[model samples]
Target: MKFTRTANANWKGTGMEGTGTISTQSTTLNNAQLSFKTRFAEGVGTNPEELIAAAHSGCFTMQLSFLLTEAGFIPEDLNTKAKVTLEDGTITLIQLELEGKVPGISEEQFQELAQKAKAICPISKLLNTEITLSTTLTA
Candidate 1:
């Protein structure tokens, strides 16, 4: 399988005053300079790591939801947060924090399902970093 997304950026002045655009025929973009990556978080567009984190978090949540449903414990709400840490200019760690309200399931089962989700999620498989999952079953 193959996929692609295009982003365009224009630098008017120095590093600080430059801007960019990332469009997938999508909702919106920014005028922040997201070139070279060093200018990240400096009034520029969202970085690659940030987009990756968004994809990872969304994928993991969907995976967990599917697992919960398959396990016969339909979740009332599923929330996931993914933190991406950069190591040596490459992504090194993806930490997933999950909280769900799932009735008729024990903590152990929730943990088990979460583990499966972590392993089976497509985004987790794509990432080369270690993934740690912390999950909680809510009332």
Candidate 2:
């Protein structure tokens, strides 16, 4: 399946001093504010890194869920957090932390499936940086 999604950003003034608003096609983020303060400093808005983290986490978790179903294991809960690290104006690493509770699945199987999801998820594939995964299979 091939599809496309888009978000729009509008900025005014210089990069350090300029402010912008981002609006997604789905309207989940309609005219959300973003600026230098939001990206590099503390501010009440969203930033690019945060958005990427959200996307990565969501994508990885969904891919894992699909793999689990395919493997005949039903997941009770799966929580994932993606951390995108930016240093020196370059994205350095992305860390994915996952906690999962699945019935009738060995820890080894869970880890293997999560590793596959990390490698195959669309966002994971799109990122051109180091990616790490830590998984916790819970009872």
Candidate 3:
């Protein structure tokens, strides 16, 4: 099983003052604006770090849902946030914070499963940065 995703970017002018747009094949983003201001300072548009955070959070949440179901627990709700840090032109770390409610699961069991998912998720395995998971389980 193989899947491929595509996104395209177009830029005009120099890095400091240039503007660009990013579009993905899925059309989730179509000509979305981006610029140096957007990346390094306050501006209107999306940046690569934001996109990575979105992808990591979505992937980790889905993986947790699958793990909970496999463990015979019905997931009520799951929310995850992935924060990526960039320093000195390098991505330093990604922190995943999750809060979940599930029926018929102990906190220890939920934490175990959440850690398993964090270790096995595709994006987690793909990234070269340090990844950390913090989970809060609610009855």
- Candidates in order have lDDT scores of 0.79, 0.97, 0.93
Window of ten residues with lowest summed lDDT in model 1: 24-33
- Pick the lDDT winner: 2
Task: Single out the weakest 10-residue window by summed lDDT for candidate 2.
Answer: 1-10
**lDDT tens readout by residue for model 1, 9-104:** 555556555445454434455443355444354444576677788889999899889888887878899999888898777788888999999988
Q: Mind sharing the TM-score for model 3?
A: 0.96
> Of the candidates numbered 1 and 3, which has the greater lDDT value?
3
lDDT of 3: 0.93
Question: What is the lDDT, from 0 to 100, of the residue 96 in candidate 2?
Answer: 98
- Report residue 4 deviation for candidate 3 (angstroms): 1.2
Query: With candidate 1 superimposed using the best TM-score fit, by how many Å does residue 19's alpha carbon deviate from the native?
Result: 3.1
Model 1 alpha-carbon miss at residue 21, Å: 1.9
* Candidate whose TM-score is highest: 2
Q: List the residue pairs that clash in candidate 3.
A: none
Tens digits of per-residue lDDT for model 3, 16-101 = 99999999999999999999998999888999999999999999999989988888998999999999999999989999999999
In candidate 1, which residue pairs get closer than 3 Å at backbone N, Cα or C atoms, i.e. clash? Answer: none
Query: Model 3 residue 97 lDDT?
Result: 97
List clashing residue pairs in candidate 2: none
Misplaced by over 4 Å in model 3 are none
